[model samples]
Target: MHIEVSGLYKKFGDFQAVTDVNFEIEKGQLIGLLGPSGGGKTSILRMLAGLESVDKGDIVFHGKRVNDLPPQERGIGFVFQNYALFKHMTVEGNIAFGLEVKKWSKAKIKDRVAELVELTGLSGFEKRYPHQLSGGQRQRVAFARALAPEPQLLLLDEPFAAIDAKIRHELRSWLRDMIDRLGITSIFVTHDQDEAIEVADQIMIINKGRLEQKGTPWEIYKNPQSPFVAEFIGESTIVEDASSLRGFGNASDWPGTKALIRPEYVEVGKPSDFKLLSATESGRVRHVHFRGSEWLVEVEVGSTRLVTYRSLEKEIVHPGDEVQVLIHRAYLFNNNDSWIMENKLKEDPMPVHI
Candidate 1:
């Protein structure tokens, strides 16, 4: 492990911020720490960065215990959400500030700043001030400054939170290219699931200062271990079925299992006869949001709710239109509890998005 955190615990006064959190991060890999606000993602990052002390636990980076190491001595780069740049400094000066403090000679600092500016696509903006640059440009400047000193690992805390959606998407793409090119080991924290899924090599989900799950984007989206994780990372519907979706248990229309279906896997169709429940179908469209080629439609089925993204090509489903949905691929969980993988139905007709 490049960075290993074990039994990490932190508390403030009466509030317990983090408890028994443990995970190992490999080198040259990009990982995402994802959760909503106040979920302790930032707290964990701060602890790793030595900005906050760990109440209990050990932090090992490249086989060295860094508990007592000062933040600067840890050799970890930090990129914050606000693109913290020296407002008075020019782009090149901002990028060179860290190296200058490290006492690098003028020629070496010049070369380092020039290389970073080129690598970050800021070659022509060397003389421009932070306020003179666009949000994306400012972000690039912040990144260049953070990375100039060649830190062992990079930590990003909600780095794209302040940018607009379009800009955020663009910057995420830009970041993917730069990090891959540099082969840097980094961990970024964000509250957006889409950001984590699209950008991270592996994702760590946090809730209430605890680790909920950690895995590839596909694995986490397809096979969530907990209910909170199942509902959070992607658009999914959980159906209470009378018969288990998997054949592990008796196949009868009795109180059985919870069926989970991703919106992309759901189609407007009648429930097949082989389905768990008898013709007990009830739903009405509540609202629809058009998403270019497809539409995200929310429906209320009895007391439960489901969201489906239907393409306009097949039957043209819409708002206020009643639908008989076919859950092409669904996860089946026992009604009694979430454990016991029983009565699973594979051989789905629809394609599972990767």
Candidate 2:
């Protein structure tokens, strides 16, 4: 289903939950609504589901306006964050609930239930109750229940929020693959940047009840149009006076002398490791954390604290040890302007005297 939301706005009494938001979704594209709590992601999803009334906009599904339509009539399947399953119903009963509501024949409901149970990997747990299943299994039941109706559109609100981190990560891949195989147009709400980046074909960033930015994961990460997106989208450190860093040029060259640096942009190691050794700035290691495969090292340069990752294969640097730090690029921005600051050494390759 192709969706077009224009001039969308919503409010709860005096509190404005959603501002003039606008975006579009093509058919069978998995889009993610990413934002912090109370940023209107759920509200927007509810509005699309016809559960919430839009204060001022048009929600067009394939060129047809659906603002006045009820939830059942919208041809959408919604799965809530809490995995709203019936405690009394068995897995088969739960999966069959929607089909029964539509008054499908008993034999047809049985066939559909069996098909979904197999598809969702719950074949042997048909008679199991919600409390009898693990969180991941219960979530699979919820997903199967939602998919039973075979709606044109599927809406998932933090579908993995209730599961453990390990299971959540596993389910993310499962859900993405399932959606692709079924070719259902899906929109999921999540505050997890990793989940959104891994699952969504396109991501819509909501902030302060407004649409901050919308693009693919790579586009938004590499080129943030606003400061909020720069900080919110990745592991970034915002420096107040980025010009103090070597090879970043002058303070006046940036919009506000403020720069955003991701861990990938900063390289820290011994002086002999870099060819442009003179262009590197001197920073002392403050802390190092073992992140399984690599070490997350924090280095203090001037008054700014920057984070970078080091391979475990390399020689480790201890705290208080001075090391060479090179910033390959930075996202510089102010209220009115935003741009990337590529280190001068990258272009010149010559040693910087500073």
* Per-candidate TM-score against the hidden true structure: 0.86, 0.96
> Candidate 1: which stretches are off by over 4 Å?
238-261, 270-283, 300-303, 318-322, 329-354
Candidate 2: residue 181 lDDT (0-100): 98
TM-score of 2: 0.96
RMSD of each: 4.9, 2.4
Residue range 243-268, candidate 2, lDDT tens digits: 87788866566556688999999999
Cα error, candidate 1, residue 246 (Å): 12
lDDT of 1 at 267: 49
- Which residue pairs overlap in candidate 2's backbone? none
Number of the predicted model whose lDDT against the real structure is largest: 2
